[model samples]
Target: MTLPTLTIGNKNYSSWSMRPWLALRWADIRFEEQIIPLGPRGLGPNPDILAVSPTGTVPVLELASGERIWDSVSICEWAHEQAPEAKLWPEVSIARALARSAVAEMHSGFSALRKALPMNIKRVKRDHSISAETQVQIDRFDALLQSLITRFGGGQASWIFGHPTIVDAFFAPIATRVRTYNVKVSAPVEAWCQTVFSDSAFRAWEAAARKETWIITETDEA
Candidate 1:
């Protein structure tokens, strides 16, 4: 069978693309990645993306069977089923539930933070001030991450589940976001984000992102 293809946007700017890419990598799933350049968020639609993705989004996972899965969370779950050994979630039921909740919140919530602080690995702004609403979102995440770290990370695991999991993939870009904007967070979460930032895969992505010449000024406008 041919390897699946993961269509992604430019690495430095595409947080959603990074999610399932990292999850599939952790799953040990051999897949090809195609990088797509992004236009500004509100300019218009890209015909190139529309041609491949029904939803007109990047990060579409085209399977060997010709099935396409969009949405980062869905792609992570699909990859999880393909590689059970990855233990995409916690083995214990309760812990797994909590992990899913966290990941879901990351997937659907945090609009304030997402809007205020987009991911830009190449840019760092010291003392960035987020709005009170954004700060609330950050505080909420800090508390959530603290609880997860206390329960599963044990204060010192490179991953939140004490091992690589989809949850880590879900929040990996937030790691870049916090650092990019110099947002204050709890020690455990900060450390975990650093761990995510330090991974070989992340480093490769960042390296590639730096080399890309595609310019999306809106993503960097913050």
Candidate 2:
């Protein structure tokens, strides 16, 4: 029998793709990946992505049953349902609510930061400057992350809520963005970012990202 397949774009630049990809891996769900390189500057009218994705975007999860999940968060939710024992969300009630909230915030917010500091795992720009708008979002991000760590981090695991969850998976790309752009964060937040970097699954993804020759010039120059 065929396994489920995840259709994604360039690993180096596709933050949306990274979310569900990491979630699936962390949940120990076995699936294949299909890479459809984005068009120049990562703005695609690409026929390949359009064929599999209703929204013509990357990170579409095609189940073995042939049903497709198109949104990143939806795909993560699906993975959680498939593997509830994986504890993708926090087990505690309030903590789980907060984790869901955090994921939702990431899903709809942070436009400035997302645009100004695109994820480029293969590159580092320590001298990159943050604009006022981006700085506002960054500050918000840092505060939210620090609060979560302080409240739910349990003083043991570096992950929020004491373990890797869908929250961490959703923010993993932002952690890479912080590292790639040298964005200064609080010590706890920094530690969480480091944990994201050190995860074996994330490392494997990073290794592949570094090997990809595809470059979106807009993000490359960012």
What's the TM-score of every candidate structure? Answer: 0.96, 0.96
* Candidate 1 lDDT by residue in tens digits, 1-222: 699999999898999999898888888999999988987556667888988899999889999889999788899999989998889888999999999999999989999999899888889899788899999999998898878888888878468989888888888888898888988998898889889978887788889988988877877777
Q: List, residue by residue over 1-222, the lDDT tens digit for candidate 2.
A: 799999998899899999999999999999999999875644556777889999999899999899999999999999999999999998989999999999999999999999999999989898999999999999999999889999999654398878779999988999999999999888888899989999999999999999999878878897
What stretches of model 2 exceed 4 Å from their correct place?
Answer: 41-44
lDDT of 1: 0.88
Worst 10-residue stretch by lDDT in candidate 2? 38-47
lDDT value, residue 82 of candidate 2: 96
**Error in Å for residue 158 of model 1:** 2.4
Clashes of each: 0, 0
Residue 36's lDDT in candidate 2 = 92
Scored by TM-score, the top model is 2
Clashing pairs in 2: none
